[model samples]
Target chain A: MMKWIMGGLISVSVIVGIITGNISEVSNAAIDSGTKAAQLSLALLGTMGLWGGLMRIAEKSGLTNVISKLFRPVAKFLFKGISPDSEAFRAISMNITANLLGLGNAATPLGIDAMKKLEKADNPGETASRNMIMLAVLNTASIQILPTTVAALRLAYGSQTPLDILPAVLLTSLCSVCVGITLVFVFDKKGGRT
Target chain B: MRFSDYIIPVFIAGILIYGLIKKVDIFDEFTVGAKENLIAAFDILPALIALMTCVGMLNASGAADMLCSAVSPFLEKIGFPAECAPLAFLRPISGSGALAVYEQIISENGPDSFAGRVASVLLGASETTFYTIAVYFGAVKAKKTRHALPCSLAADLTAFILSALFVRVFFA
Candidate 1:
């Protein structure tokens, strides 16, 4: 699937660029992509380290256990087979907590940790497990309680009430999360034995 | 002031105080965790470059714009502004690109305009599905993503469709 998507994108881009006489720009972007990607990684490193460090402290202090315990019911419902007391569930709960707080930088490192745990337990194979897919879906449809960056952008643009759209954003995100989880469940039922 | 400003500080403080009370070697644990995470970051670089290259090519070649234009008519039928079509298309594909489209919409239409409000909500609600999927799955060396991509795209579709509706219902 990744191969097909990548191939199709590259080929379609080349074809379109040629037709539109934008081939030079396309080649330039492709060539510069590595530098842009490395720059992004560098930017991400500091936050990842800070959050990763803090999360490690949380884990060692048993703070994650408390959090996982608090979210046990939700985890039980969403994660199915995973034990609420397990490392994977703990990491998953922490990731969800960070996401809810709109701590996106914190969320990624925690999420990566959770994925590693899930991979260790449910999937030793190359294909992703059902739980893994669900986790990814949940991250994508994350329910952020405060969209600070969007509000800030609105403020910068001189809106009278920058956060006026907060309710709409929250509602939209909630609906999408519900739909996303439901779709994952549907896929799980259809696929069977993952 | 945005309430979000205090979240990180408060969270960090809470974690530190808790760790100290629990007798955890906080600094040692922190460095170990940071080291592991930094190493994990390297695993994601290849995927990042590949996905960014694809997105960059699409952006530079104007293929994204063409796709957005093709779909704008259908979007107008649903009362979603045609100007935001590019945003909805780019939102799942690239974060920075989506932000650029969103800023363009607000600057062009004014922040309080209907289109601007919808774009704001749209941007706030959705994630960069492709980027998140690539990085998270990439870190684990997961080859076949199975239903993850389709499910995420479906959620993005739901978010895009609801952004306009919710904005209308709440703000109109």
Candidate 2:
């Protein structure tokens, strides 16, 4: 879906550039953006590599287990009826923690694991359960203590204070999470009719 | 050497120490995991390259400028920067797209400028809504999304509105 949209959009833009006699500018942009993407990938490489490795250590050391215990009460409300000691609960907890710390790439595996575990816990129905819906909403609007990726871009762009947007990020994400959870509860009750 | 500068290093140290306490081979494990991470980066390189190329074409084609002018009157009335219109549209669809646009905004306006600050805040606040929905739901094989899409979009909307207001109050 996304690939098609992006491809069509790009084609349209290129055609527009040709019509407007900006083909050279467009060609330059293609080259320039390729370089920027390469640079962005390099920036992501270090941070993502370091965090990925550290998270492996954290996982191996049973840190998430300890944190999972701490996450129990919160998980009860956020994902109620999900047995606290279950695999789904553990995966969900770890996923949420990864998101909170702003390790989104790290969160992906855990989230998919959690979703699979959740699908297993439920009956053999294809429809999404309440827990699945809630997890989707949570992941979609998950709070971030660090906006690492955005900050990386800011730093690459020569921002004097890369983390200066932290407070506003927090404020906006807080609003998003709150609104997201509220809507989830309101809609999930009627079997997502609203 | 601000407080935030210490966070990443501190986090890495904490994990390594904890791994040592757990009797794990920290160096070997880090190398193992980092190698896998590098492979992962390469895996996404194609998509990243394609998306960025599109971002460049769109930007250079004057489409962004056209959209900016199209909304300039309403934007001026609301005291919002017209340059952010493209960002507001692309953010939910693609993370790299918005990031590329943001880098452009800051490069032109300077990072500390009002538009740049708002772009930073807005970028941080939201997720790639369409991408997230498609990925997670696809993972679970949930054919019927059942309000999840609309609800997540509402959240994105909330983030958008708040980002503008919060940026003004905090950065201004």
Best by lDDT: 1
Query: lDDT per residue, candidate 1, B66-124, as tens digits?
Result: 88778888887888987788788778876765655565578668889999999999888
Cα lDDT of candidate 2 equals 0.79
Cα lDDT for residue A34, candidate 1: 69
Which whole-number lDDT from 0 to 100 does residue B169 have in model 2? 90
Best by TM-score: 2
Candidate models: Cα lDDT each: 0.81, 0.79
Off by over 4 Å in 1: A1-69, B1-70
Write the residue-wise lDDT of candidate 2 on A1-194 in tens digits: 66786878688788888888888899899888888778878877876677667767777788766766776787788886678879999899888887876667678888988988988886426777778878888888847777776777677778888887888889999999889889888875766332
- Tell me the deviation in Å of residue B64 in model 1: 9.2
TM-score of each: 0.68, 0.88
Q: Model 2, residue A165: displacement in angstroms?
A: 1.6
Judge candidate 1 at residue A82 and give its lDDT. 86
lDDT of 2 by residue, B8-67 (tens): 678778889999999988888888777777787767777777777887788788776777
For candidate 1, the per-residue lDDT at B108 reads: 66
Cα distance off (Å), candidate 2, residue A97? 1.8
Residue pairs in clash, model 2: none
